[model samples]
Target: MPPTIEMTTTWERTCEVADLEPGWGEVALLGTHQVALVRITDEEVYAVTHHDPHTGAPVMARGIVGSRGDRPTIASPLHKEVYDLGTGECFTDPGLALRTYRTRIVGGMIEVELDR
Candidate 1:
């Protein structure tokens, strides 16, 4: 079990690290907020608000994960908009991106850091 990382005020037990397969994604509800947690690599994971940056709809979790010139990204299934998995920066447009959250694993549990 890894040591827990204290971020913000409340601590959340989101998912188990083993439960998340690398290169795959998962959606979990933390409180009233729906979030998409994506595993981009063996040690890198991204937690983004499930709402789409373009439509404000919860669909980012269904987006496809891929890479563009070594930049890991997710292509929105709704509009095909590409977002950087690491930074949540949109690739198709200059100023479009989904809100990103901080994530860490503690005791094999995935924890998300959200602003309360």
Candidate 2:
């Protein structure tokens, strides 16, 4: 058995549950970090570093969401680089990836897990 990793809630309620429609991405500031919270499907929500992994630009949150084969990904609006929403892994470079956060909806509010 492995040691259990504890997940702690980081972000406060940035937006109401109604504020996020299905299949959309929004930028929210959690502490000092900017995060891109995306609704991939009706049941799935993903949180990733808003900065574009390729250009070091803060614009992934505005990227369009789609799938490459079966992997749900977001295409950067600046350079069209695709990243896996779940893992924040660059589709072109596996070694290059974004930091991903745990996201959950509770009491009609959405929160992202933060590293303390």
| lDDT by candidate, in order shown | 0.83, 0.80
Native-referenced Cα lDDT, model 2? 0.80
Give a tens-digit lDDT track for model 1, residues 25-103: 7899999889898986556778888898998888888889899998888888898999987788998997897788878
- Each candidate's number of clashing pairs is 0, 0
Error of 2 at 103 (Å): 0.7
Each prediction's TM-score versus the true structure: 0.84, 0.81
Best by lDDT: 1
In model 2, which runs have C-alpha deviations exceeding 4 angstroms? 1-11
Over 4 Å off in model 1, which ranges? 1-8
The local lDDT score (0 to 100) that residue 88 gets in candidate 2 is 80
